[model samples]
Target chain A: MVFTTTKFELLTNKVAASFGLPDARIVTVDHPLGGTDRATIERWADAAVDTVVALLTSG
Target chain B: MADKGELLEIVDASPEAVMDYFDDRGWGDGLPLVPPTVERVEAMLAACGGADPDEVLSVLPPRFGECTRRMVAINAVLAGCRPDVMPVLVTAARALGHPELNLRGVNATTHPVAPLLIVHGDIATSAGYNSGLGAFGPGNRANATTGRAVRFLLLHVAGARPGPGDASTQGQPAKYSYCVAENTAASPWESYPRSVGVDAPSAITLHCGENPHNFHDMEADHPGPILEKAASVMATLGVNNAPIGQGEYFVGLGPEHAATIASHNWTRRDVQSYLYERARLPAGLYRKQFGSLAWFPWMHEVPDDHLMPATGHPDHFKIFVVGGAGKHSCVVPSWGMTKSVTLAVAP
Candidate 1:
């Protein structure tokens, strides 16, 4: 599974396809990942945790 | 010779209409483009001296588009490049695909880094490249269009469009066109390629770095004060090289500055040594700011207040003379993970 931000959602999709991973599992979060506060990042991580776990467990 | 991609058919419209069509499709670089007719592309490809037009030279990133001789020539025509400049662009495309360059990360990172092409040897003159006063700036056709052709490959083939594929925070002017030729005759040292042990009659070095940051000192008769100032510029907290120990810095010394430094009987290695020893900051400062410090083992073992050099070694300071008669010099900071590649232009 791949973790990315919305700003890179399209690029992730394109790059994944190019590498022959057309069905690569990707979990996308909101934009502006680097410049945010710790609490905000933690919140984003918490929100995306469920999707990451599901991708890890299922086909 | 076969074309690489599918042929597009458009109406025989006015020049303005054609420009509009290209702009709508994201082909225009906010500047007017020369209509790349099939004849012009064929003429540009003919300059390659029998290289197969359909041969895939490089597989560019983001889109993984196959870059063939035909596509490069087509983009060259669109950039208004003369047939003589084809060899430089072809060599640069190969350099872009080199693993050392890390072009994928260069395009993906939010840092405003662009590839700066330095043309060398007979081709620099035969192709009419500007290496004299204001070389990095505009005013020369061969330099301008050849540089633009490289960018067009990123745009058309690699699909590194500004918003999506490039992802730069605040894209710089160098992203449009960044190229210059070494003023080898004006310099005190040998040609840059030869200095680096690439003994080709003609070559090109593609370094992915921020735009040139000019530093000028008019009254310095000796190399000490002038070089010390350059070290101070490198030690700044804002530059990406501070935390990344392996980062490379290309210091372009103006001819007058090079002459002054040479008067001290300083070789290129001497300048590199001086800059490496001086371009430093307190290790504590780096630790306080960034969460992770990507340094060498010795750098990591140093005490908090110990002064650490900007990069790992003196060899990281790649020195060469550029520009015309002036006391001005410039430093180009790398994007940290990428390495510059120098290759001979194909005959």
Candidate 2:
């Protein structure tokens, strides 16, 4: 998490090798996270949730 | 008046306090998360038939980590997904694992195009994925959330955060969620999966589409001339022939345009062949002074050369007829200077 842009291959392999999954199974989207991995992932989830909640709540 | 048998200890905690716990722990995508309340998480699990959330889908590489169903649920909840939509998310994730898809490359490249999801069969209509007018735009929950869920999974579960793992150059808006459905009812051709070779009840198909450029031609209805115009745009200076080696292009033929081809009694293959031939650049245009030099190395070697083949192969072009009725059709230029990897949709 909290990654730089344009590292699709490096990141893909990292995620795959980290979890022992093959590289083919993952697709990276362009969402920026601003800290360490654990904190970053949490923030990303929260941001996404906020967008969803805003949409749902407004509707 | 509440009876507390083995009641859990209750403490008032601000929402931010809870978010901090997850956020500071680096357990999220730098955004705060709604705490995975037991009820919410349980509901999510039930949607997937109550499977173990910890079951590993894969151990993502480059960083070496495990992605489990439970973790995915956590992100889905955060992504604002309902439990009922979890099946579609799972299927899409599984499809990303397809070898032909080159997910690793897609995830790491600086290309603006991300995986574009196309749902086919009964599931599309049942799930409320739009294949009609404004299908590419937002509004449908199934289309929006399903696509959002994938992005969430990649960010949280797989950890491809921008400036970290993701490296898209002029990142596209489609990165948020590029899911849509094929307008099978409107399309004159068979389902895309069938064309690509797959049995169908309904499933998802994934492709990579850069910024979509339109080809609006109201002047013509005949398939031959229309496709020639369209193909020329696809192979034109800036937009045409970006494939590095052998690559595929996504051509979404609108119903009105497709109907024109049908009127001329041209099968999809006939149109493909016609476009394939017409899409080629003149040999003289392949010089270093011209921008076609980006793909063909021979251009530099020959200097003022214009005779080298623009595309590595004629079959590099792939067609998928879709969109609502209109004289307009479009080609989603490949972001990579190469062909996109195609993967099958899974159950």
Candidate 3:
């Protein structure tokens, strides 16, 4: 399983496949995390917490 | 090409058709390429001696493509490399796979880092490689094509494209081709390979770094002012070398610059030591900006007022003379996670 952003989605998939995890569980957030304010990042993280938990909990 | 690995032969193997075909499939390096002909590939392979064509050198990351000797020949041909440079190309392939070089990080990082190939010893002149004026610039066929061949290898074998595979935000031009030779003829000291204790007839060094940052000192009769200018370039926080522990700095001195430095009876070690002492900012400034750093043990133990070296060790400041008669030099800063590897040119 992996947590990544939208920009790295394709690269994550490519990396996953190379490491023999073609179907690795990958959760995507927004495109960028750098140069953003803490409040915005925290809000995004808060909104995505439930989905992340569900994905982790799912088989 | 059927998949990423298999380069299938197209029926229309003409020059224009081949270009369009590869361009359409995201295989071209955004430049005109010499079509990989069977005869040309055969010639390139023949220069590699009795090595197995199908032998898998190493599995490159990001795409994990199995790089074979035959594929090396194919890419070399496509890069317009002369058959005489086959052995060097083969060595370059093997060096890229070295664990210490960290090919995986270099391919995936967003630093605009490119694998800089430094050719040394007899190979520079033997194969018509450039080690003189405009060494880092264009016009020399051997230097240009050989460097282009390595980029082609990364593209075809390692599967490193700009966006998907190579995650560089704004990749620099060095990503296209960055190869130069040590100006042994004009250098004051021994050849770079010999100075580094490599006794080989010819060797190649692969360093993943940003483009050269030019520094010039035309009026300096001594080495102090010259090296001080270079130190100023290395001390800035913008470069990766400023914060990282093992980030290497390759200070490329021109002929006249090296002569000026050598006239004061300074050895390579002396130059390194001088740069290590001079290329520093106060430790307190670094601590104020960077929350955490990949610093060497000594950096952490130092006082707040202590001048912290950009790269912790003196040895990390790699000094070698390149370029022709000029008072200019350049600093090639490493990506910090990768290490340079030097290997002999053999099949």
Candidate 4:
């Protein structure tokens, strides 16, 4: 969760490393949520993570 | 009396004194701000994984000052975001600094638009973001804090302190913080990320916007005429982005409305094409009010009567479906000058 004004990739990589996850483990996706609402976005995020975790575990 | 705890003192002092302190220090929002303190700032920093407080995220234009992470923490703390939510704020700050996001030009524009935060993926859920009813209002921590922190950072860090350089005729409510999550459960079409070709997992997108104009069509069960209505509103003149040429537009379709479109086997692009084709305001509507509306210099030879002159490239209309299962839709016009840009949210 470290935020760098510069070097975003490196920062995300650091997080993956801390989690004992490979760089490939880090997934990056564009947000589908509209900017005008919050609950909808949160739900989508929750679903996205669930889907990702399920895929990871199934593999 | 050398330094009798400024935080405690400000809390105990008069509102006038507090405003004076912030104004004197150029920390107020041209209005006023709740005084920020060490305890509050630390709490806010904790939201974003407790990163070092001194990291610089942006050097905003107009004032062109370094928006250090610590300063951002202070503002976020004051804005009342949970510490973990700070990463979202940081990602947003990072996005604003992107050359394409063009916060400098946005801040300077006379348009009544503000940066709108569109959150996606796991972070939105982890932070308890609101994507349901009243999702845009103050009760939601993720929405309130993430958006407000950006506003506070913009003012305190980047220095868009109004009356100095940010001269909007009527600044929007979003100036305080305008962030929301999408309701994917309700959307039948591919989520925004999928439409844009990203498959990773989560991200944050941005749209420079004025207020949203809702389309209430509970009477219509079908998606076509409802979409037509939405598009007509989108193409109307004197609205935020319509006065100018194309850039990007946001269509926030609620669940029932989204289902209608999805049931029709319409992909998000299909819906976008429908809207784009219909976004034609009369040529007469533009010439009188927006004198600057004309063909690009390269098209000087083309006749002026061309319908729907190209305001930007074809990718101008950006669309996504979210919100509860309600009979409603919304169209948020672009700021008419800036384009919507998406930045991946850092974990």
TM (chain A), candidate 2: 0.29
Pick out the ten consecutive residues of candidate 4 chain A with the lowest summed lDDT. A1-10
TM-score of every candidate's chain A: 0.94, 0.29, 0.86, 0.34
Residues forming the 10-long window of minimal summed lDDT in candidate 1 chain B: B1-10
Top candidate on lDDT is: 1
If you assessed candidate 2 against the hidden native complex, which CAPRI class would it receive?
Answer: acceptable
Candidate 2: interface RMSD equals 4.0
- Considering only N, C-alpha and C atoms within 3 Å, which residue pairs clash in candidate 1? none
Kindly report the docking quality category of candidate 1: medium
C-alpha displacement of B261 in model 4, angstroms?
0.6
- TM-score to true structure, per model: 0.96, 0.71, 0.96, 0.75
Return the top candidate by TM-score: 1
TM-score on B-chain, cand. 2:
0.80
C-alpha positional error of residue B299 in candidate 3 after TM-score superposition, expressed in Å: 1.4
Q: B8, model 4: CA deviation in Å?
A: 10
DockQ of each: 0.64, 0.25, 0.74, 0.01
lDDT of each: 0.89, 0.63, 0.87, 0.68
Candidate 1: list runs displaced more than 4 Å: B1-3
User: Candidate 2, which segments miss by more than 4 Å at Cα?
Assistant: A1-59, B1-36, B49-54, B59-64, B237-243, B283-310, B337-347
Q: How many backbone clashes does candidate 1 have?
A: 0
| Tens digits of lDDT, candidate 2, B217-247 | 7867578777876777677656434434345
Q: lDDT tens string, model 3, B239-335?
A: 8766788999989999999999999999999999999999999999898888778998888999989998898789888888889877789999999
